[model samples]
Target chain A: MIKRRKFSEALFKALGLSALVLAVGTLVLLFGALLIDGVGRLDWQFLTSFPSRHASQAGILPAVVGSTLVMLVTAFVGIPIGVAAAIYLEEYARRTWLTELIEVTVTNLAGVPSIIFGLLALGLFVYMLGLGSSILTAGLTLALLILPVVIVTTREAIRAIPVQIREAAFALGATRWQTVADHVLPYSASGILTGIILALSRAIGETAPIVTVGALTFIAFLPPSPITDQPPYLSFEWLMSPFTVMPIQMFGWVSRPGEDFAANAAAAGLLLVGMTLAMNGLAIYVRYRMRKRVSW
Target chain B: MARPVDGPYIDSAGRGDWPKPLKAETCELSFYYGTRLVLKRVSVPIAECNITALIGPSGCGKSTFLRCFNRMHDLYPGTRYEGAIVLYPDSRNILDREVDPIEVRMRLAMVFQKPNPFPKSVYENVAYGLRVRGVKDRRAIDEKVEQALRSAALWEEVKDRLSALGTSLSGGQQQRLCIARALATDPELLLLDEPTSALDPIATASIEELLQDLKRRVTILIVTHNMQQAARISDWTAFMYLGELVEFGPTKRLFTTPAKKQTEDYITGRFG
Candidate 1:
């Protein structure tokens, strides 16, 4: 019996190691291929320039700018809504079927595919709301796609907070909102921030939803800045301006007949990977600092 | 640094101090966590300016009884309370359906066994109570924080590091900070649930000494597992067994010569 148990244990270890190798090995190979193809193509000029009919002249400036702006809008809309929903779920919501229903919905929504969210944006924001195929429409759609992720992370963060902190605050006569806004939220802020950054990174790489929302495959001009002035003025019309993000641009390139555009796609892919890694790094740092700050 | 505290202390000390002004009183109070009745009908008088210690073995509902004073159990739904917890001056039944737990908590502050300080500077931890009560002036907050810390006997240890995070302190210091936080608001009653169970011997002694000093200023109700601790600092001791009040009286007499057979057995190292 002992010999049989040993054999099973050895088999299990081999299976687990093979699975790990398969996953990591694939990621490394793909990243290695992108590095070789894209490194020579990357440059300040390539970063600064806009797309062109000639693949060599094509740069990802508009897509980069568009992605950055869209990500900002996503953060602006998603984080507040997500955090509020999370606070209600974890703090204020009584243990009732209604609260349970909301929780179940959020859990299910988190598992929905990104492309479905794109279709949702296409229908709701673009067509029904008459927002057109604009940066705002794409951003709003991406925000919807990521809201579940943000809310899940935020709820997890708030839930992980020791019950004693809440009890301490309430014991000192803080109202529920005061306890949450003053003590609970501040303590879990790093976790919330890390969640947001990770969610934004998810949105950053999303191509299907942005494309589904009708972002142009190629764009040569920057969307007008959301802040500009004739005098003491700011403009929001850029929110309605057409745009393309990095993944959409990259997808467009990789699908073309020519090898040059494929090379262009590889370079854009490298940049996208770099941005995602930077965001993940920041998230990890925030979590580390928060852990160091709070012993309990 | 002066702030208004509980009014007119009629000292509840000395055997013949007749009809002490009560801070709070519980009458036939029982508590339930769902359908399970954890605290049987318990009646006890909490005298102003004295420390009343609740002593019992684990799960005897001493903590639950202490939490009843401030309605701490309100955070969880389906946990119900029976009978009355009356605050003396207002004579309001704190368990009344219409009473706000928040307001009840303001009048009665609490500290837990484990020190839980917000992830802010020590100064912020003490000032939190005042800020919640709308004391916004920075100078006033600073003064009160200092006073409260001083009252808790932690000011000397933490004076130079007020800006340091509350969690940065030793476990004992953090517990003291929690006490200071409670004191900052000057609640009429302070509830401590095993405040020193997590502390080292020296830390426990310091807190016990502080508690002795604190009883002269504000009424305190404490839950302790240590019989000697109850004997040491508490003016009145109530012994509980199986969610029922076994006996209660002045601490010295209760420990030296308990009234009931159960109390005697429990205090004499017999099976709890």
Candidate 2:
């Protein structure tokens, strides 16, 4: 009976180990295929030039610039709003049904599909708000998509900070706002940062919402730069310009029927994956540093 | 000094001990955690610049009563405080609706059971109270930080590591850092809820000694499970049981002689 029990335990452990290996194997295969199809296509000119009808000449400069611009706005619009909402829900909100309702709604919102968010953005931001099919609209659309994730992560981080920390602050005669700003915010900053980056990572690869928001499929010129070619360089004109992000560009390429277009699309996929991994890596690194520094 | 009241003294103010000028006094204070009442009508006067200890068994509401002084009980919802905790010098009822808990806390600081140091530099942790109180002058904050750290007896050990994070210190050092953080605000009263419960014997002794010196500077009220520590450090000992103040008097008298049978039984370790 003991021999049978030991054999059953080992079999279950082996099965669990194989499941993990299978998941990693799938990821490795996907990366291998992307590398084989895309590596030969990567070059400085491909990075710098605008897209062309010929697949070899087609570059992703406009999409790259667009994604960068839209992401800047996404981070700018999302972080403060997400962090504030989290702080309100966690710290200030009363133990009432109203707070519970809002909390449950937010948790549910995180599970909503990207396409539904796209449709909502199409109605609210593009048409009703009259923002036009611009980078501003696309950024705002993606920002909405990631808000739930950001809020969830921020709330979790703030919650992870022990209650005694707040008690210590309050006992010092610090005001509620002071306690949050001083101890709560500073202590949970790394967690907040990790969440924001993860949100940004998710936002970076989103295609449907931006597409539904009416991003341009083919663009020859860059959006107006925030930094001017002259003095008094800062400008807001780029916000209203037409844009196409990296995922939408890859989607456009992959949908067309040709080997060359598919290969170029694969290359763009590689770049996009690289960008996402960089963001996730940074989040992990920040969390690791924070863990090393702060024990209690 | 007011003569030490003996044997379950419930109403000294009615007995005409009114003009003693207390630092603060809770008059028939009742506390509720949700629907369950945690503290019954507890009326205790805290003398200015003296150590008062509240002792009881686990869940006996000693900590709950201590939390009422600095409004620590107000941190969560479903917990209610009824009656008044009136502060002298200002003569304001802290439990009044208009009286801000923030302002009350500035005068009545608290040190918790576990040492919770903020994840910042030791200097920043100590300077935090003053900074939040709007003391922006760099020189003034630095001076106060040093003085507060010195007062907590942590200056010599942590002077070189002022820029180090508070969590990097030992548990005892961290508790002292919290005390310095409280002291940085220059509060009139310090409420300690089991400040040394997590420490080793030597660390506990140091903190108890620090309490004796600290009482000379600010009024202190501590809730402790260690009966001997209460006896050793506190001038006034208030023994509580089942949410009621069973007995209260001088520490020496309370420990040596029998006032209430429950207090005698608990102190003698017959039962908690």
Candidate 3:
């Protein structure tokens, strides 16, 4: 009997190890292929110049700029609203049927298809609101797509804080706001940041939602200068300008019947993966600092 | 043993000085968490500059009773407080809706069962109460932080490393740091809910010794499960059973000759 149990354990161990190896090995192969194909194409000029009909002359400048601006909008619009909703749900809201319903809905929302969010943005922000195929509409759509992820992560972070810590603060005569501001927010900051970055990274690679919201596959001109030489020295005109993000641009290149376009798509894919990894690295660094200070 | 009629049980048989002057007293304080009544109508007197320890078995509402003094129960919804926790000098009913819980907490401080120090520096942890109260002057905050740490008997070990994170300390040191945080505001009353329950024996001993020194200035009310700890540290003791105050008297009298049978049974380890 013992021999049989040992054999079973060994078999399970081997199965698990094989599974892990398969998954990691696939990722390594894909990344290695992208590196080999795209490395020669990457250059300063390729980054700085705009896209063209000629594949060799094409640069990801406009697409890169578009993605950055859209992400900025998503972070600005989604993060505060998501964080606030989470705080309200976790801290202030009483446990009732309505709150429970809301919780269930939010959890389910995170699992909803990204294309569904795109359709919603198409109907609401595009046609109904008359925002057209602009940067703002695409940003708002991505924001909606990631809202559930942000809220879920923020709530998880807030919930992880020990009740004793809150009691200690309250015992010191801190008001609810004071306690949240001084202890809760500062302590949960790393977890919230990790969640935010993860959500943003997820939004960055999204193509269908931005496409549904009316992002152009090809764009030559840049959005209006955000920093004009005017007295205010700031502008919001770019928000309303037509845009194309990295994923959409890559998709357009990949569909073309040419080896050069395929290489272009590979380069863009490499950049997208790099961006996501950089975000994840930032999250890890932040979480490390927070964990060192505020452990229970 | 003589039982005082219609008031808190005070067995002043062995001691000549019976009343030590009331810092605060609860008048039939009953607490309810939703529909379940946790703390029944229990009247208890906290003597000024004296350490009163509430001893009871687990789930007997001793911790719940401790939380009542600072209106800590008000933090949650559906938990209700009935009756009065009247503070001296002002004689204001802290349980009254008119009286703010935050205001009551400012007058009193609490140390929890587990040491809960903020992730901030030792200096900032000690200065937390002052910061909440809006004491912004750097010199004043520095002086108070030192004084509070010294009062908690943690200054010598942590004086040079004031900027170190509070959680970086040993378990006992963290508890003492919590005590320092509570003391920084110079509260009228200090509430401790099993402050040393999570510590080692040596750390527990140090904290008990510190409490003895502290009772000279601040009135303390502590809830402890260890009967020996109550006997060693507290001047007054209240034995609670099933959410009711069974006996309240001087520590010496209560430990040796408890007026009630329940107190005797629990004290002698007959049953909890």
Tens digits of per-residue lDDT, candidate 2, B1-272, equal 22334424533333322324578877778899999998887777788888889998988999989888877777887889997888888878898888788878888788899999888999999998888788899999999999999999999999999999999999999999999988888888899999999999999999999999988889999999999999999988888899988877777877987467888999999989
The CAPRI category of model 1 is medium
Q: Give the worst 10-residue stretch by lDDT in candidate 2 chain B.
A: B10-19
Model 2 alpha-carbon drift over 4 Å, by segment: A229-232, B1-7, B10-21
Task: Residues A173-271, candidate 2: write the lDDT tens digits.
Answer: 788898898888878989999999999998999988888889988899999878897778789999999989898889889999999988889989999
Measured by DockQ, the strongest candidate is 3
The pairs that clash in candidate 1 are none
Q: Report each candidate's C-alpha RMSD, comma-separated, in the order given.
A: 4.7, 2.8, 2.5
Query: Clashing pairs in model 3?
Result: none
The best candidate by TM-score is 3
Q: How many backbone clashes does candidate 1 have?
A: 0
Estimate the TM-score of every prediction: 0.93, 0.94, 0.96
Ranking by lDDT: 3, 1, 2
Could you give candidate 1's per-residue lDDT for residues B58-162 as a string of tens digits?
989999999998899999889999988988888889999999998898898899989998889999999999989999899999899999999999999999989
DockQ of each: 0.69, 0.76, 0.79
- TM-score of chain A for candidate 1? 0.96
By DockQ, rank the candidates, best first. 3, 2, 1
**Stretches of candidate 1 above 4 Å error?**
A1-18, B1-19
Over the stretch A63-123, how does candidate 3's per-residue lDDT look in tens digits?
9999999999999999999999999999999999999999999999999999999999999
User: Clash pairs of candidate 2?
Assistant: none
The digit string of per-residue lDDT tens for model 3 on B81-142 reads 98888898788889999999999999999999999998889999999999999999999999
TM-score, chain B, model 1, is 0.92
